[model samples]
Target: MRARLTLGFFTITLAAVALVSVAVLPGLQSRLIDAKLADLAELARQYAPELRKAVGTSLPQSELQDLVGRTADLTGSRVSVLLVVTSDGEITVEAGTDSATERDITLDFSVAIEAATSGRVSRGTEAGPNGQVGEVAVPFLFRNPESGRRRVGRVAVFSSPLRDVEASVAVVRDRTLVAGSAASLLALLAGFLVARRLTRRLEAVQAGAGRVAGGDFSARFPVDREDEIGELARTLDNMRRQLAELDSARKRFIATASHELRTPIFSLGGFLELLADEELDPQTRQEFLRHVRAQVDRLSRLAVDLLDLSKLEAGSLELRPESTDVAELARRVAHEFHPALAAHDSHLEVRVPEDVVEVDCDPERVAQVMRILIDNAITHTPSGTDMVVSASRRGDAVRFGVGDFGPGIRRAMLPHIFEPFITSDDAQGSGLGLAIAHELAERMAGELLVESQPGRTTFTLQLPARPTPPRPAAPPVVTEA
Candidate 1:
């Protein structure tokens, strides 16, 4: 990974540098050539007037050559004076300062010819004897004193070689290569280091996950970074904590369930062995049989609770919803608990509103949750403790609650009260009723809320209210007009 990432960065940087060179080098060369031409054209313009006056006077060829040489020295270019022969229409170079053979150079005298013909300055580039050359020509006009008429007699051409411009472009090309190479190297190093660090962090997370997968829940992911990786680490760490808690709960549940199941089976076995004694009296056999029946009942309830809990956990528990009066449902569920209330020597008061508290919910599931809450209250509280089942409507919701006037639940157990196999005290039942109730409430889009304090504990099921539909309007009577 590190090698690949480094190479990727280096390749991108190299390509960028190559692209910049490709785009900029040609323009740079063109501009340099243009600047050189402009300088040559300006020099030709400044020296043309002097050469024209000298020509009108018919100055000696040697002195004209000297003057041209001096101008060339100052401008760092070749200066020449060319005359147009009217009879043959031929151009002849009268004097020059450069050493190039005039015939070879004058073969392409387009700039000078254009200047002489147009009577204006012209500039262009052409191939010279030595190399490419830039030329600027200014027309030389001679004024006749007698008629006061001006005529173009000669053209002054300023020429310069393009080697300097080529040299500058070469230097820039070399420097760009050097800088691009250095940048590519730096990118490679940076990419390698970054990729290495990233992979190391990922590996640490992988190791932690592996440990968790192997059932070592104590391993933790690192969360010290302040980037995306850090956020991932934090999320994984939170998940690990949850899984660890669940694992602990699972172990406790297995141990408790095993013990609960074993006791009933053992009691039934002992009762059967006792009933097998031939000498045992009829009353003793009947008592043993009763004990066996009670154990059997305990076993049956645990089996049913376990099945419900498994279904809830698997998300296969379906609900059948309908618009039902919650007040009446609460009364019915409370009345069903009368047998247990009598056994516990406790009375349950039903406090429901006179008006219907209608809500959209599964009546059977709602009754089941109420039964769980009521049974939980009776089982946990002491004998003779009174209980209350209440139902009412508030705003857009209807609430059915079961509460008890007994010692309240412990503060520490409130958070896990709805967890499977969780009991507040050493109660003689599978502790899955609250878990099933909680799941049922959630499936019905309702909530099971609890509030407990000394001598008061309530578990309330709150479901959204179903509004009553409006009656149809009466048909309008139509009489013949």
Candidate 2:
């Protein structure tokens, strides 16, 4: 991955440089040639008059060559004066600096001819001895007595080689290549460093996840960075912490469940062995049989509780929602516990409003939660301790509460009271009831809360209240015929 990233960076840099070079190099050369041509044209215009006067008179060839050479030195170019022969309609080079070189030069005089014919300055390029040459021509004008107008008499041609512009462009091209290579190298180094750092952080997170998957929750994710990687690290670390807690809870649950199951199975085994004694008295055999039956019942209830809790945690338990009058539901559930209440020597008072407390909920699940709360209160409280089962509507929620006037729960135990297999004072019931109830409440989009003190302990289930739909108006009664 690191190598791929570095190559990616180098590839992008090279692509950019290639694009810029293709776009700029040609234009740069063309612009430089144009600038050189313009400068030659301006210089020709400045020296045209002097060259025309010299050509108009009968000056010696050496004197004319000297004058041309002086102008060439001043302008940093080759200077030539061409005579326009109107009679023959032709142009001939009258004088020039570097006579021998100019005679054999390859420069085409098209610009000088065009300037003489048009009576204006002209500029162009052509093949020369060394390389491409830019030339500019300025026409010399004189009054024509016969035509009553000015006419070109002579032309001054100025030219310069384009080798300097080519050299400059070549230098720029070479520099661009060097700079692009340097930039590409830097990009590769930077990419490798960044990818290395990123890979290390990701590997650490992967290692931590692997440890957690292997049931070793001691490994922790790193969170030292302040980038996206850091945020990822922090999130993974938080997951690690949560997984660790869940693992600890899972181990504790397995231990408690095994112990709870073993006790009843051992008791049932001993009782069954005792009952098998044929010489035993009838009363003793009956007592053993009773003990076996009780243990069987306990085991059955425990299995059911475990199943319900597992289904709730696995999100497999479906809820059937309907509009229910919790006030009526409360009375029904409390009435079912009459036998238990009587057995415990306790009275369960139902406090429900005359008005219906309507809610959209699964009535069976809500009833199950109520049973758990009421049973918990009865089994934990002292004998003859009174309890209250109440249902009421508060704003947009309906609450069902069960309170017992008995010794309250320990403060330290309240936090984990809703956890699986939690019991207060080693009570004689499977401790999965409150955990199942809490899970059910949450599944129904509600909350289960507990408040306990010395005199009273209350468990409240708060569920969202569904507003009752209004009834339709009745049609008017039919009139008598």
Candidate 3:
């Protein structure tokens, strides 16, 4: 990844440099040639009259040649001037002395050919040894009063070697190449650093995940930076902790369930073995059968508890909800418990407000929860324990309570009371009632909470209240045989 990133940076940087060089290099060469051509044009204008005088008077050619040589050798200029004479389809060429060897001598003459053939001023560039030369050709003419104006027997072409302009362009090209190389190297370094920084955190997360996959949930990553990577590390750590806790809970549940299930099965086996005794009396046999029945009942309760627990854990429990009156529901549970309360010699009270406490919940599930709490209060406490069934509204929720004045649960057991297989001295009933009630309350979108102190223990099921609506009338049914 780092290598890929560095390559990407280098490619982009070099591409930009190449593009700029493509655009600037040609324009630089063209502009230099244009400026040089402008200089040559002015020079041709300045010397045109002198050369014309020397030509028309038929003076020595050395005089014109010397002037051209001096102009070509000027301190900072590398210009070469040529004088041509064309007549009867024949041509003669002469160059300035000092600039002869500086540029290529074989320059194309298409523009100069047109000028000599048609007597027109021409300008263009041509290749030379030192580089490209910018050239201009102007016709030479003279006037005689007797014959008016007529073309002279000569043409002068102004030329420059262009060595200095070529040198300047070379310097620019070299600098661009150096800058581009340096920038590409620097970009590669920067890209590697960036890729390393980003991938380091990801690597840590990967390692942590591997450890978790290997059944080690204690692995953690640093979360110092307030970045996305840091947040990811924190999230992974939280998941590990939750998983560790779940694993511990799972182990404890397995051990407890095994012990609870094994005890009753053993007892039932022992009693069934004894029932096959031929020497046993009718009363003793009946008593042994009763003990076996009790063990069977215990096993049945355990099976039911395990089934309910599995359903809750797998999230398969379904609830049928209605806008039901929880106050009336509490009253019904209290009335149903009257017989059991009487059997246990316990006192029961049902209290609710005159107004309906309507809540959207599965009424059977809520009733089941209330019954469990009432039964616990009746059986787990001493006889004559006053168990109160009450319902009232608070905020947008309704609270249904079954509380009793009894010795409170031990603080150590209070926290785990809602866990399965926890009962008072493993007596009165299987320890799954409260846990089942809690899960049922949850399935109905309610919360089951217990608060206890000496002489007072309250289990409250809080459910969301719904505004009371008139109950729908049942449709009439027609009977036909």
Candidate 4:
């Protein structure tokens, strides 16, 4: 991962450099070429009139050759002079650079002669034996300016192609290479530093995780940074702490289970031993047996609740969802709780709509949730306290709730009431009961919502109503062709 990240950074940096260099270097070279061409053109314009005068009116070929040679020497170029043909399709190369020159220099005398006669300037590039070359031609007319008719002699100024453009481009390429090398060195140093810092922090986290995995639950993470790595470190630390807490809970559960189980076992063993005795009071034996049975029942219930919680946590609990009348389900579960309510001197009052309020849910699980809620209500509310199981339709959902007029759950404990092994002062049962109920409700695509205050608390199970399918649209009629 680190290598890939470094490579990605380098790739982006290089790409940016290449893009900028591609756009800027060619443009700079082109401008330099134009500037050099302009300078050469200006030089030609400066020498045009002087060259025309030196090669004046029908000059001999020898004098023209001498003049061209002197001009080439002064301009530091292989120069050429051509005479324009009047009403003819040929140029007379009167004098210029050596014709047998091995440098393969051929001046474009035709274009130059044409420009001179037509009174215009033109420029072009051409190939010679040596290589590519540039030429500029200016037209010269020695006509009588006052006469409407014309008769003329022509001379053109010429030089070799400019070399400054190539030189400038070479300099630019060297500079770019130097700059790119320096940037790459700097990027390498920066990437190394960043990667080192990140790896160090991650190593620390990995070491902490190793300690936790090896059963050292006391490992904690550094809380120095506020970035994502820091958040990960903090989460790891939290997991360690939770594991420590769970370890302590496991020890407590073991001790509690042993004690609870041992008491019942001792009672049953003692009662059976007494019953086996040949001499014992009948009434005393019956009392001991009854107490043993009650303890056994309590232990059995505790074991059953623990098993149910395990099923819920492992996601192995199955739910069969179907449409059921909410009011009737609530009534049946409430009736089952009559004995427990009477024991607590509490009365169960049901407030369900007479109209069929159907809801999509697993009827058995819904009934179990209702039973748990009613049992919790009966246990928490003191004698003469009133409890109600009600059902109502709210929008597209049906809500079945159990409410009690008792000292409601404490505000602080409300959040975790549905969590496994969580219980409140006002409610005491197998703490798994409400947790299981909540899990069941959720498994049926429903939610268990709670509301509590000083004198009243309500637990509502909300489930979605069976959907009504939309009617099909009619097909449009087609016209005959």
Candidate 5:
């Protein structure tokens, strides 16, 4: 916008200059021509009386020419004098000694002579053999004493006006053009400096925004100036600090709630175990025992989820990476969940290649992911449903999946499925199971993905594969330190 405004200013200034120059040029040229004509007319008026006295009483033609020559030399002009009757006219040339060679030329002087005789001055520009010249004619009148009538002779003057007018206008035009050009250049330099300053602030804002988007709540902008941009930067910095404080408060709340819940739950389970052994009817003991077990399970799940969230947030979850057979890992987790599957009337099916599909991952964390997936499938699916656990090599990675035929997760809930405490009506396990599994998988340099439709759901875990050297067995321990 600034650049455009500057350009507009320059355009208007230049146009105004051009218009004024154009408007004044023709008038100035005319005035210059008229002034030269007036000077020549005045010189003619002064010389006319002297010339008439020199050509007194019908003087010889040679003597009249000599007087004309003397007048031309004194005035530095090419002069001409004419006398005419009703039927004929005579002309004599008075050439200047210092001027260029004189050329005899024909001109229509009848109009000029008529104007001079009518007591009016006549002046005009006319083309000559050499170039354009300014011409002026004035009448020389004397009284006839006996008849008391007027006798008249005409003196005409011509001079070049083009060179003088051109020289004067050229100077003005050149000055105007130079000033306009310099102004334009200054405007461009100013625009560049302003653009650079504005872009610098904008770039800093852009970088701060990028950091904020990347989850850096502590990211801030520099406050170096007191302009609007500086105010904006300070506001952003304050917002970042506030966000960091809020985030810290939220994490602290979660940690405190998880820790406080653990103690009472452990006590309740311990007292319930003692009560189970006391003298009581079988039915009451069994009911109390079942409730205690449920409470224990709930507390265990909450504790696990809180721990996993804390580890993920703090960036302190250590991964013991190793290359292991991913297919075997999936099968092993399925086997471990066999009892739970059976209890739910669900059947576990393992699908894997006979050859090992190796991957680089934390074996324990990968197995934990498989356990979470299989358990989730068993808990969500209807009784007697088949839970399939499968693993395969997919390009540079190995993929392990646990799928179930059940009333799958709704589309709206899919986005938040891995969030802690998120659950559907069909979900029986702690919601943190999936969340913990996802965090652990990522720590092991792998990923966990979920896909579900109306009647099917699959959780897939993928990890990179590379050959790893076998670990050497530890040497037998010696008694010596």
Candidate 6:
């Protein structure tokens, strides 16, 4: 990753440098050439007037040499080539530091013809005998004062070699190479540091995941940035905590479920052994058989509870919700549990008001929830304890509650009451009734909540009320019209 990141940064930097060089080099060269041509044109302006006074005739050789020498001195171009040519493209006068040498260089023959005929200054780059050069030509015009007419009698051509511009460009190329190298080095160093920082954080997360996979839920990622890496670290830490909690829950659940199932199975085995005794009377055998049947029923109910809890966990618990009176459901479940209350030597009380309190819930599921709450209230409390089954309307919900006048559940166990196989130390049942009840209530679009105090414990199922539909408007009377 670090290698890739560094390479990416370096590649981008070099690409930018290349693009700037390609875009700016030609324009730079052209501007420098234009500047040289402008200087030559200005020099021609200076010498044209003197040449114009000598029009229609050739100047004396000494005077032409002096004029060309003074023009070269004023232009101040160190590497300039100046020439004075006749309209027929003959070089009449030439000036340089080597004025002692004989003149031999020729102007571009076509350019000289154009200037002398057109009577205007023209600038261009041309291939000179020395190298490429920027040159300008100015037509020496003889304008008629009265008729406002002009005639070209001569042309002055000035040329400068392009070595200065090329040398400047070479220097720029060297500097660009040096700067691009420095920039690429800097980008590589920065990219390596950034990638290392990122990968270090990711490695922490990877190690944490491995630990969790190995059943060590305590591992956590610790990155404190404000970027995506930090968000991932926080998410991993949260997942670790949740996994730890779920791990604890699963361990406790397995232990509790095994204990619950084993006790009933062991009891059934003992009852069968007693029934198999050869000298046992018919009454004794029948009693033992009844005990075995009771244990079998316990096992059956536990199995059903397990299946329902699994379905709830899998998010496939089905329900058929309808508008039904919550009060009626509570009363029916209370009456149905009266026999069980009698068997346990407990009393049942119904406190539901039949005021048409309606809720959107599955009637059968709601009844199952009520039965679970009532059974818990009766079985968990002492014999002869009075249990009340009640229903009431509060705002937008109808609440059915089962209350017992017995020792309440421990505070530590209250929060986990709806969790499967979670129970108090004093709990004797399968420890699955409330979990199943909670699931059924939720599947029916209701919530199960519990409140417990010393000597009073109440579990309530709160279901949303069905909205009352508005009545239809009365028909208008025709006689009124």
- Please report the candidate that would top lDDT against the real structure: 2
Candidate 1, residues 1-481, lDDT tens digits: the string is: 7778788988999999999799999899999999999988888777767776776566877787788778877778877777754547655444443323456455365787788778789889888766778999888877768889876678778888898998899999999999999999999899889889988898899899899999999999988788998998899899999999989989998998998899999989988888889999988888898899999999999999998888888989888888898867887888888889999999888877666557888899899999999999999999999888888776778888888999999999999999888889997668899999999888878899999999999999988887765334343222110
Instruction: Compute each candidate's TM-score over C-alphas.
Output: 0.87, 0.84, 0.68, 0.74, 0.48, 0.80
lDDT ranking of the models:
2, 1, 3, 6, 4, 5
Please, what is the whole-model Cα lDDT of each candidate in the order they appear? 0.83, 0.86, 0.76, 0.72, 0.69, 0.74
**Candidate 3: C-alpha RMSD after superposition:** 7.7
Candidate 4 root-mean-square deviation in Å? 9.8
| lDDT, candidate 3, 215-251, per-residue tens | 8878887786999889998888888888888887788
In candidate 3, list every pair of residues with a backbone clash: 104-129
Off by over 4 Å in 2: 52-63, 82-100, 109-127, 139-155, 469-481
Residues 1-481 of candidate 5 have per-residue lDDT tens digits of 4566556656766676677578876677678777777776677677756775754358777777777777777765555565534334533323221122444444544535564456455666666564546655555565778899876544444333356656776786788778867866775676667766777787888799789878887677998899999999988888888878768766855665655575557768676767857687788777777877777776777777678778976888887787788766776677787678768887677777766667777888788788778777777777887777778775677888888889889899998787665666644555677878888777767788999998889999888778545444333221100
In candidate 6, what are the lDDT values of residues 1-481, reduced to their tens digit?
7688778888898898887689877788778887877877787677656655653447766666665556656654322233445547653434422222344354343455556556577777777566677766666666667888865645656556788888888788778878988988898888888878877788888998999989998787886787898888888889889889999988888887888899999998888787778999998888888888888898999899988888987989888877788766776677787578778887777776535667777889888888888888877888888887778776778888888999899998898888887666565678888999888877767889999988999999988886765344343221100
Ranked candidates (TM-score, high to low): 1, 2, 6, 4, 3, 5
Q: Pick by TM-score: which candidate is best? A: 1
RMSD, one per candidate, in order? 7.2, 6.5, 7.7, 9.8, 16.6, 7.2
- Colliding residue pairs in candidate 1: none
Instruction: Give me the displacement of residue 162 in model 2, in angstroms.
Output: 2.9
For model 5, the superposed segments whose C-alpha errors exceed 4 Å read 1-290, 467-481
Which ten contiguous residues of candidate 3 have the minimum total lDDT? 472-481
